[model samples]
Target: MIRRTFPILGVLTAVLLSYGLYEALIGAPTEQSMGDVQRIFYYHAPSAWTAFLLFGINFVASVVYLIQRSIKADIIALVTAEVGVVFCTVVLVTGPIWARPVWGIWWTWDIRLTSTLVLWLIYVSYLILRRFSSSGQTPLMAAVIAIFGALDVPLVYFSIRFFRTQHPQPVIGGEGSIDPKMLQVALINWAGFLCFACLVCWSRYRLELLQREVEETEALEALLDSRKAQ
Candidate 1:
């Protein structure tokens, strides 16, 4: 029963995400200020949110893996970290694209941008640490790194908030609220991005499982060969 349900769930998620993307791109209204470039918001905001969500998953899974010593939890944490890194890269790339036209700059050392950059570096380091650490220490070291890296999320949010208060609010959300149509577009974009993220994470996790199974089989075969030789 459980095995049968995953395919159905995957199909449903794909359909919903496709519909949401259509709504965001063709149906939703454009921003009066940014024009067509505003469409990037559909991809950008959601990428940022999904990246944060994935990192949160990694943090929780890492802790669980450490406590339970379950390979499943470790696999989940590893998969989530990788997916989160990809989304974070998207967010970083799209942010500059959106900013170039509006902010008249490609990059800035503003609090929000700086903090987000820091978060990206933290997770990238997490990935590196996991890759280089000795096999026996991988799980314990990864858990510690994930926990420490997650602290950057709250710091980034607060830094952005404080920065806005100190500096003039960006044209995107300043002196008023988002238009109703633009807001709807943003929401739909978020939904599509979230569904896509889930799909990617699921695919990666399955691949990881397959690799582990292959390794286990090889190990078993090696043990059998050793016994036969004896």
Candidate 2:
């Protein structure tokens, strides 16, 4: 059923993303203060939200895997962590670009910015551990790391509320307000990004499952050959 739906989902995702691009770049009104540069916020904020969601899912999956030792759960944890890192990378990159012109610098060590960078680094480490580790307990270790990493998400989210920072307070739910039309466009872009992220995760999950099956088969064949020699 899922296989059958992939094409349909893929097409829908493409349309949403393309329309989102059009709306963000042209259809949406330019900001009075930042003008064209503020346009990056459409992509930037949505990417951060998507990354936060993916990391949250990763945290839950990792916990499940730790408790049940289920291969499926482990695969899900791995997939979400991988995709989450990519989305977080988008946030990190776009943030600096957006900051450069506004802040007159490419980066800052403010609480929000620093914590976000740390969150990205932690997940990047999780992926590195999964990729390079030869230990049988790699999944367990990775799950532990994932849980630790997820703790930072809240800090990244609330830093602006708690700390005086170079980063502006969140427009959605803070002291500041946003134009309704810009908010609408931001939301449309977010919906598009959410759909795209789900599609990517689903595709990655399938590929991971296939790769594991091949590895297991190869291991089993080797074992059978060694037994026959005995």
Candidate 3:
């Protein structure tokens, strides 16, 4: 069932992403203030939402791994963390670009910006721990880090609400509101980005599982050879 669906999903995702690009660029009306520069918001906001979602899944998977010591759960945690970092990186990069023209600065040490940078650092550290640690307990350690890192995600999200920040207010829920057409385009772009993230996560999970299988097979062969030598 999943195998059949993968191709269809790929095609659909491609269509959605292309249409979303068109909508973001040409279809969406120019902003009264920022003008075309505001178009970057379509990409920037969706990337953040996608990163938050991936990290949330990573946190859940990490918790499950800690409770059950399940290899599947550990793999999930690793893959999600890996992908989440990528989207998080996009957020960090795009934010500075948007900020430079608007705030007349490339970066700021505001609560929202700082918390987000910390969030990115935490996940990068999580990935590093998983990659470099040779201990068999690496998964457990990584899981613990993931749980800790997830704590920062909420802080990053609510920083603007709780503190004064240079970042713009939320369009959906805060004091500011978006144009109806802009909102529609943003939603469309977000849907495309979500689909893209799902596709990437699924592929990464499968590849990780395969690599594990190969590693186990090699270990088994080496053990058998040693026994025969004895």
Give me the candidate number with maximum TM-score: 3
My TM-score estimates for the predictions, one after another, are 0.84, 0.89, 0.91
For model 3, the run of ten residues with the poorest summed lDDT? 166-175
Q: TM-score of model 1 relative to the true fold? A: 0.84
Clashing pairs in 3: none
The order of the candidates by TM-score, greatest first, is: 3, 2, 1
**Model 1, span 59-104: residue lDDT tens:** 9998898789898899889988898889899989998998898778
In order, what lDDT does every prediction score?
A: 0.81, 0.85, 0.86
Q: All candidates: CA RMSD in angstroms? A: 2.9, 3.3, 3.3
Task: Give the clash count for model 1.
Answer: 0
lDDT of 3 by residue, 144-194 (tens): 998877776676767655655455543222327789999888889889988
**Model 2 C-alpha lDDT per residue in residues 1-230, reported as the tens digit of each score:** 87779888888889988988999999999888678999999999999999888888889999999999998999889988888889899999998898877767887566667777888889999999988888578899999999887776676667644554455543322226788888888888899888888898898989989998999999999999999999
CA shift of 47, model 2, Å: 0.2
Sequence-dependent TM-score of model 3: 0.91
Candidate 2: residue 199 Cα off by (Å): 1.2
